[model samples]
Target: MPKQTNVRCPNCGIQFAAPVETVIDVSQNPNGKMLLLAGSLNAFQCPNCGSPVRVTTPFLFHDGSKELLMVYVPPELNLPKPEREKAIGDLMRELTAILPQGSFKSYMFQPREALTLQGMVDTILQADGVTPEMMQQQRDRLSVLESLLGAPEETRPSIIEQNDAKIDTQFMQTLSLLIQRMAAEGQTEVAQQLAIVQEDVLAFSSFGQTLMRDAQEQEAVMQEVAESIQALGAQPVRADFLSLAQRYAGDDQRLEALVGLIRPAFDYAFFQDLTAAIGKAPADEREKLETLRDRLLELTQAVDAQTQAVIADAAKLLQVFASAPDEQALDGLIRENVAVLDEAFLSVLLANLQQAESQGKSDLVAKLTDIYERVLGVLREQMPPVLRFVNELLGAPTPEEQQKMLDENAKAFGESLLTTIDAVSEAMSARGEDSIIERLAELRAAAEQALA
Candidate 1:
């Protein structure tokens, strides 16, 4: 992701700033294509008039799997040769730095420069074998998707049924992609609508049934593999795993999928059992077992390396957290890693905090506590303020006291606050605290009536 920056809107001739990605390496960020499809990567809407603006700043797009390396430069800018080369050189450095070494091909050194934003987008689609006919079909699918989404509730289903030709496996996938993007950008309402439409498509379309069946079969394969392991006693040997693999190896993809699903189980003792079995097996059987071991090794090593990289990064983050001299800086670092503030990271952080507390690092404990607050504060955005006020009103010891407090804080009640209340309610429901969710609704209703 490139830094958010200012750009001139050609439609309205207004200057606005937005997040503009300049170097999109799909190998690094797999969602780059969705961003491109959603027209968000270089998309900026004019602030003054809400007109669409394509900020065709220089960008280097890459997808290693497709052998795609394309760049875009605004013709209007007419940048000098030396300046263009310098920009390209810097982008090349940034791209290569993120990618695996020697993955760069000679074609990459001469990225095809796009004259227009559509041209850049077309270049990417073409890399994925999207022929002109396919491109037109995609555009048609997009138009139908918009029509169904924008249609009135009573007519939406009819529109969907009429254009059943438009709704395909690819159409549902496109909707899924858009939903992912919307949710990521905090456009929850749009994401929710798209999700409903996607479900309708899945329930009504023919290709949807085929897709669903395929997914079910894939899931069942893993589930059967998991269940079959029960036949192996609590302490199963390498022989047990080999039997399981032999049962599934008829379909290699299924075998790999099973391996991936049960990857965590392939720890030290599991390998030790396999090694022992290899030693005991006769020549032909031993060779077969050895190959199976190698296959598992290949699969597990690939995944484990990725996990190890995350763990290592988490470890480094903990180190940074430990070294923060003040609470504010600690909060800053925590905010930067909100998406990665997951179980793996939080568990590691807890271990670090425990060490700090055990070592009499009271100051560090206070900072960690602040970090925890900020982490929750992300989910807790606009939540705690309203929730706290509601609680205070609820427990003011009397109805009169509650009313008095509500009167004093009347300025804080608005649609924005109501939206936050609903948001918090959703969060509380997701967390399975329905009891509190009921209270939230009651509080919001009271606030809404009072404001009315």
Candidate 2:
């Protein structure tokens, strides 16, 4: 839990309450660890002048996985020796009191002191296997990004061309993370500027262009394979999948897409059937079938591995939310990690919620439910206004209710609401969602009349 402390803004002199995090436990509060690494922990913008202010106070950093305990006190604080020692002792006592019994180790008593925040960050990164060279490289990339962001809009292309070599996968990833962080902090103008820089980087840099091209090709492959599977009808049997696999035998991307899209269909029984068919195949066809079988085995293994990794990451993130000390902290974590709140994460949350309910863990079930709703709320807030309105209209229970909603919001949405309804109706129709399509059609009529 953060301590709300009165902070006087240097720029405006107006005082405000800021949540100051004095202790970061990596095992429990991973989100705090992330914010600390991002250099935004205890950072706030003044309400009066909107100037960034950072709280400089003594804090304890603990990572149980690494068996690391460290303490940092801002040098600028200039506390007397005894006062500093007492502050450190207080933080240590607070940490030890909350830790599980018998889990305290010797390192907790004699916490290592970091002379500076950078030194503390470096030590943490080093423990995570980030070498000094890697750190320098990251710093270089960050410098280049800063230069790009600082340059004039018209000059960005040339700047990117000059520093194209520094613009690699890690650089782009860092830029993306910065954008997300800025947006989460409500710095919309800065986030928008960073977004423009990202587009220019993707446009001008060599690696960025390659990434763009690969993304396009992958999207095309996904669409083609999705259409193929859709053509397989509602109930595609094992033989149907086998035939589909053989059709795209040598095309690794399409084969990968096929396997990823319908991984469950390629079970042990399906593979056994394939082996049987391969054994009975003619000599000319046997080699091709065998090759396809080998390739599919590799693809399935890769897909399963990737899925497991995603699930593990999702579970870890969910645990962070569950361990949040308060609703405010949980909401902040959700907003900070919003970019990763995808179907896989939601599925994991749902499964956990179901298990808690079944096991009669009412408290856990309630917590998970709150997290789930908050996650969905954040996601909806990110959607376009039209889509959000459509979602609200759909949530109305009956035609009368939907019609009432449409009437209330018609002036605001105008004809755009009718257009969105039509688009959604078409999409739902294609997916064979008859009930939804019917409701959308009626709503579309009502909306059109309302707008008219």
Candidate 3:
């Protein structure tokens, strides 16, 4: 977990709070690795100036899947050789305390240190087969993005004109991807800023403007596809959907139209169409057709995964709440996920309660509500700082009062709350309290080993 530390902005000379985590044990919660890759792991937006600043702290990156362990200390810190060795020793000790007995490999004892965070990330990406050329392209996009954001409104056009080639379809897609991630993580302000940038890109850049036009056509095609699919009788199966796909032109235009529109719905039926299209194509063009099919298949899987991950968390929490044999089990689950009392979980509980009520079950509805509140009370007791902080912020008399409180206690409330948020976000991918319990057990077992 990141700690709250003071940061004095070079430009503004005002100090603000930021999160700095030194040890990231990705074995327990791999989602932390994702946040790290997205560049949001330890990023803080200065409330005073809205400028993004990073905490200049060393971090350990661990990925058990690859049997890899590494550390990064900023060269700017310039710790003495003895002190650097001591710090690395301390960090590794902590890492050892969070893994199961004998789970760590022999190579982990000899630590690898990076002089920069980028070097650490690049190392990981290279292992994943992301080419240096791809990494350079990403860096180039970021450079142009920085320039555009820094330029004045009047000068922005010139910056855009100079980097017009860089601001192509790929850039727009990258921006859209980031925006979705921000929204999912509840970073509303950042998502809004990205949206504005997206709008400006779509309006100002020639390629962006053309892509926007194509997107409109895509949406139209999607609407028509939806209408066509719905017009089929109830319980339409794979055959029915494929029959609809056959109505489109057999050439590349049809494939493009199909992909442009109903991309997410490319299930077995769509694959059937793709198979037929591939079979009909000339041998030379068959590879291109197969490539298109492969792309859509990958896209469909991703779309389905994102949806399931978002909603499955809520559903899983509900199941745990309803199935707890007694208060102890409920307490354990709530402590594990922290969303034991969230509304989505409650909605599921309420639906079950209503089902019981409809069947004339006695006191089940009241029983469910009581159990929920009781478990929530336990969470408040266990993590009062977070619970109290969130309560007061929400219970503020007015928006202005809320803002004032946040500004005054930024350090007390902000970094601490963010730690909990990071935990919760990681938990979204968890199976339920069971997975969380197993994870915590692993940590506890490792801690005990350190004590031994």
Candidate 4:
């Protein structure tokens, strides 16, 4: 029976042994020599320090020293440069003979590795008096590798050690090949692969876009703060400006100028909304309507509710801190309901006015006129901003109109077409020129048919 031994790491008192495909040389010993065998014995690896432990095996010797079973191999087990060169030459000749006749001439030689292999061969040829035999050996080795590339993936072992690294490299290689094929033949499958790769890139791009948008918003806030400080000399700074500055403190420096402008715009807008609510015209006699005037008293409460609702929804969607139910939105909802009631009240007032006029009640008519004039005066004070707000809301474009804006930009459309062309070109490099031309012709035909 053959004697067995275990391998352990000499350092850190750990054991580390595994059967790797590659073997090592270990012939530099003072006593004799040794070979680092991969799978002759059980190799142990230390869990703590990851050291290889060595063990000895009892050799069939008559009362002699025991032989070390597990050996440590050094590097450079392969042939020297001269011998290796000779071997490579022989390999190339063998490869050439195995290839189908005229394989080089008839086939356009779509070697994906052509550039790399050729560069290596060029470096070799730069040396003086290198014979064809030497070149042939290199070709043989590469030919073998090419065959492996063509083989089914499951049959070939992955050469890369790390799973993540291997996967990423394979994906990139696959994508390059796919793109080349698409360019040459415009295959639908190739296009689909390109789309998948694009989706992955876009996922990363969205993060950058979000960062940019946030930066812009913050910059706007800061600008407003700076302007206010300059104007008021920073004594008892306005409450609104202070809040705006604090909110955008973490934003980019460029935002300081924009921040100043943004707050004034918002303030002006708020007042505009207020005036519009007060000054809105009464609805038609027949059609009762919730005119802006009815919302004048509770306008601020409504806006507060709207703000809280927007914030809560955003937080919920972002999966951040839980946004509790806000009383502000509730207040706004109440104000809207009150406006509905006011419309009905106006209708009743109009009815009472008609009744008094029909009965010739002069005193009652005069009292009703006074109330009507007072209401009109209040409406006049608020009319400008209220109508402006209403106009802005109604005048805003629908989704369809926004889409049209994107579609109609001539420069953008041209740029998009250019992008598609670039994608096609990138894919074509992997595929052959003939294939690409053929595919383009097919596409042209299809387009003509569709037009017809």
Q: Pick the candidate with the highest lDDT.
A: 2
Clashes of 1: 0
lDDT of 4 by residue, 332-423 (tens): 11211221223334444456678889999987676555544443333332233323322232233674442343344323333333334344
lDDT (Cα, tens digit) per residue for candidate 3, span 1-452? 44456677655678765445678887664545766777656555445554555566667888877777888877898989998888888889888888899787977978787767788889889877898999999889878776765666677777777878888767877787677555433355766666777777777888888988888786666556656665776576666655565465344444455544455456676687779878988898788667766765655676567556756766655664566555434443343344234555656666777797888877777667766676556445434466565455545777567656656664555455555544543443232244645543443333233333
- Write model 2 residue lDDT over 1-452, tens digit each, in one string: 67767788887799877667898887767768888898778876665665667788899999988999999999999999999999999999989877888999877779999998989999999999999999999999989888988999999999999998888889999999998777665465788899999999999999999999999899789878878888999888999998899899899999988898788989999999999999999989999999999999999999899999999999999997898777655765676677789989999999999999999999999999999999999888666589899998889878788888878887798878878888888667545577999888877877888888
Better of 2 and 4 by TM-score: 2
Worst 10 residues of 1 by lDDT: 328-337
Query: Listing every candidate in turn, what is its Cα RMSD in Å to the true structure after a full C-alpha superposition?
Result: 10.4, 4.5, 16.2, 36.9
Q: Which stretches of candidate 4 lie over 4 Å from their true place?
A: 1-162, 166-187, 197-246, 251-452
- Candidate 3 lDDT at 38 equals 72
lDDT of 1 by residue, 136-250 (tens): 9888988988887887776776777788877776787778877755544444567678888887777667677777898888767656665676557668765577667756644
Kindly report which residue pairs in candidate 2 clash with one another. Answer: none
Check candidate 1 and list the clashing pairs.
none
List, in order, the clash count of every candidate structure. Answer: 0, 0, 0, 48
Worst 10 residues of 2 by lDDT: 44-53
Distance from true location, Cα of 393 in model 4, Å: 26
User: Against the hidden reference, what TM-scores do the models get?
Assistant: 0.49, 0.80, 0.51, 0.15
* Best-to-worst lDDT order: 2, 1, 3, 4
Off by over 4 Å in 1: 1-37, 42-116, 123-131, 152-169, 227-258, 264-452
lDDT of 4: 0.35
Compare the candidates by TM-score and give the number of the best one: 2
Q: Give me the displacement of residue 404 in model 3, in angstroms.
A: 27
